[model samples]
Target chain A: MILEYKFEYLSNNNTLVNFLTNIADASDMKFEITKEKNEINFYVDADEEAMSSFASTIASDLPMSVFLQNTAVSLVQEMPPSNIQADKTKQFNLPFCPKCLQKAESAESSDYYNPFTTCPMCCDTKDIKEFIVSFGDEIKRTDAYKEVFEDLASRIHQGLGVRFKTLSGTFIFEKLENLQEDKNQKDIKLLCTNLANISNVVVAKKAEIVALACIEKPQMDFRINELYKSKNIIQAKRLSVRYPNDLILYLLSKELRALGIDFLSYKNEGSYDINVDFENFDAKESLKIPKLKILEQNRALVLESENYDKKFMQVFESLKEKNKAHFMVLLYENSLLQKRILNFYTSSRDDDNVSYYAKDLEGFLDVLNYRLPKSIQEVFEDIQKEESGERLLKNYKNKYPDSIKTALEFDLSVLKNASIVSFWKIAESILGFKNSILDNASLSLLEKGPRIDYKLFESARIYNKEFNYIKLIQSGMSFRLAGVDERTISLGYIESYAHFISNIADEVNKEMELEGISLSGDIFADERISHYVHKSIGKNFKIFYNKDFVIQTRF
Target chain B: MNILILGIGNILFQDEGIGAHFVHYMDEKYEYISQKNSVTIVDGGTLAQRLIPLIVRYDYLIVVDCIEAYDSEPGDVYFFDFENAPDEINWQGSAHEVEMLQTLNMIRMNGDLPPSRVLGVIPKRIDDDTAFELSEEIIAAADTMEQTVIKHLESLDVSLRERNPQITISAMAQISFKREIVNDSGI
Candidate 1:
């Protein structure tokens, strides 16, 4: 097995260099330093026994060192069983490991320390020597002779590993084989800057290259990663731990893919990892199944995660009114409260039209395999229930709250006694106008003292706000005429209000145009009628106002 | 050379009305400058579209307005060749109009838009007040801007000769005609 370790120390401090130097001077072990200023890498060659001992000593001692900031230790390649002349020379002696002796005596013990016997006690192993020398020959034994070794060597024998600093924080690992498999699970990959030294390429036989690749690409392939590198690794790690579920979502996507299930994975699609077709097992033929949409939601690890009720409701409401499916499958990890939430939502809805499957990955896969009912339509009797026109309009309004004009029309259509004032009030609410738009336009006309109400000249008009005074008067008169006789509401005021409304609407349209919002047909039609009415009623005000066509003032 | 002085700004915003006020001030005190057959002073007044034809027609155009071009003292005056002005010109248009840059670009798209110089003053206050009067800093900047505009006119070989007593105020006023008609049909 090949052993690789990366230990990072502050460049300003020479403690790491001094420590490695001291070890090399004290032993016959030859180590090469690939030093680039602050970073000093040690590449040592030794027999299996010596390497294991050295690895164990370093793994136990280095992690606690103030100067040893970070270290990656991996066994590059397993030494051929009998290649070492020293090991072959000692083959005749009993390979005595006191730890293996005690371990074999336990009920869990699979094997005792013997050259020929594979030790089940040390760890499930084919060879007794492989058990004692797993990490690095670091474990101490009460043998007659005192022999010291590094724990990292035995750990490497157990698995290929890496230790490195990432933007997210220190990524310490004991194994890195399934990384290539994990990378293939998602289309998105992390771009680790410092980890560039380790590439994603999987090479064979060359332990050095493999070790380097493992170090550089751990971020790309591991569950322990982040969206972007933090300037301070420590802070990033602390923050990352807070939202570990977000980190898990990235991993869960891979886990789901590993299950070999056919599902469409959508990135951040309404806070879910995937949308699986429960009824249709085949990708090509899944669309044929009329009702098979299942959103797979993954909850974060925190005690209180984002509420899915509102978000799920909004999503269910916006489903292209034509979509056949409406169901959610929530995947939770170690969350006991999630079951209660699922139950709460399931029982809260009046119709209970939505089917839900909530559980952890293992439980979810079990449900997917043995429990899920086929054809969601069979599960939901109200699948074909058509929404009323008013309900549809309400849903539309909910979806587009910024569309105030449409909402106003919807409100007016539903009102019991919709008067002109009510209509204007609706319009004002939609336009975000605080004061009555009609009143402001009309009162602005009274700015010039005691002017003839009909011939409201420019000097008499107030220009404080954007409104046409004449159209306001016309709208006011039209409102009065709805209830009062024309004998009371003079034609001049009516004409003035008509023009005012027309001018204000046109101005509003122009303003909306600048903002790149094309007004809907209903709003456009309302404004257009005002403009056309004013245009057709030209000069008729003179006949009505001069005679005082005397009517009572509604105000 | 037919020289046109176009002032542009939205009067709804207090100090933004500086351009409109400058044009009106020039119309009163420097109407004498119009004695030169080629000189025309226009109050563009929040209407970027209104200045398009005049911009393309004039041989030389000088624009006056409140500009937030650089981080400087509020009343600092800046005069520069409009063609060489920074692309990051801080001129926001009113809700009903295109920006000044867009209007100028439209003219250039049609053909050449005459040699132009933009005389700008950084305003101290641009509060959301629909008042006609300018702040004191703006008023002071306007005085300095007047001198700079005079210098620019001199460089263009145009001088503000004293008005002939014979030239009636109405005649001088006629040159200030608003191209866009106001629809006050009832009056």
Candidate 2:
């Protein structure tokens, strides 16, 4: 038997003939194929049994039944109905379009498809029973990704998204349970890829968003490649590749490299997308650091897709334990919600970790440049302000004056015979010149023994639990007094000492705002005054010179 | 030639102190070089500014330090002549109060810098640490660094004679070398 068939598509004919030849060779049959412009003819010389089997295989494998109407006269006269009719009638009992009563078209191929399957004239599918029935009871069975995947395709067509591939396709998707789970993925991936002429790219962070291809035309990929090459970016072509998910990651890696941040993917089984070690990071590479979660020893960042619906706060909560000392960086998402969440966390936890919902890649970079140093500087300033020990000593000095009066008097009596030069000198010497000798070390309570000489301040108020007289004397010594130590002890010095003691009483009263401890009313105040009394010969009355008399009465 | 081998670095920071380590190595291993030749080996420590006059007084100044390799691998040794290196290459980061390149440039501006060449190695670890230890990679490259300096000195027509090899290295060899006289008249 001899069989001949003509094919208008040379590619289809070549593929069909090649397949048939392999089959015929196994069956010990001979075949010839001849080609012309957009035409190819196949001739098969075979026995009846071989010819029958060959026709059966072609009928099943080639989808040739669709064109049976056109091939009826030239080839087989007794042709089966077009497979389009067979396929439609077997799948759905009702007509696809109730208005036009439209059936599956014979000439339609996968190349010819409609995202909107309803006839354009009707502009409504209310009358389509099969269309409505398919979605009626089984609407919940529709895969959630169908709409989003379609949106991604549209975004590519509108020049708003880049198409690339990753290890898990372009997206990181949770497995959805559905009747058509496998078929739906194939359809969506195919449709989105064909629509954009590039595989859809999965974007999780602001950096990846910046890496999105904004090219206006199909040829623009090459232009981007050229541009990247001129800029000495070695991964430009990989980043510009139309298909595959690694391109966006590759582009982001380059941008991070410029910022001295090494961008890496999850090496272990983990929820986060990227991890960066800040130890090797060059601070001078850029001014800001983006939203970063500093771990105990390392740092990481997680970027969610713009369509993410999971509770991001919950993820951050877990991250806090791992990064107690670090900041949490949320990508540009709901800004108001991010602020509310960050405010709550900071207030409740007493951690100033920031949640930066960057408006764009540039904004994210800016925060990183500014926040790192600012945070470090703030820590240093806090340390500087902790001079609590010094403040405590000053409080003691202001609260108790009578406690040191006796000691001050004793020191003066010893100095009375040395010399008489300046009154300020005697006053300073009576104050024990503690400010000149003690260092910052001497002021610290950690050192054993009294910081100041106990001979200078004799009252227990100086050594009381709330007041350490030693620290007071040491702190007093910390003050600067120039040329006072050089002057000899004189009446002028004694006068200054009395004046200094009275001034201390006035200053302490003003500072402490004591309710009842008046110089005249307090028991210790009278004793302190009487200690300074000295006999004097006077015409009218016996004149006693005390600290108050030396200071108030200028004789 | 009157030669000064200045080693600069922070001795407290592990690998960043490689320059000081190289000086100790040179002082002990090649003591004859300094004793025989007019070579002065100074432990510059982290103070590059204090060595400005020493840079001007020497006929030939050789600096040994650790370098930030930038794009290159760690332990990679590089030699740069002050008068003939690329401008960008001189911007290598330093662990000192002032970077080595900036110090050299200052002396250059003064118009009295001796012919200077920096022999440096990219350290494998410049991390935070207090130990004076070196990374294995840098320790392995130390001999090559010594040879590189020797070859540069040879090119400058300076010769070194061996000392009595029987004499053991001493603790005093670790000390920084300074001229006894500060007056320029002695030079």
**TM of each candidate vs. truth:** 0.26, 0.25
Please state the i-RMS of candidate 2.
Answer: 20.8
Candidate 1 C-alpha lDDT tens digits along A213-288: 2211111112222322232211111111111111112222223233321111112112211121111122321111
Which candidate has the top score in DockQ?
1
Error of 1 at A398 (Å): 30
Query: Candidate 1 at residue A217, lDDT?
Result: 14
Q: Give the Å shift of residue B48 in candidate 1.
A: 1.8
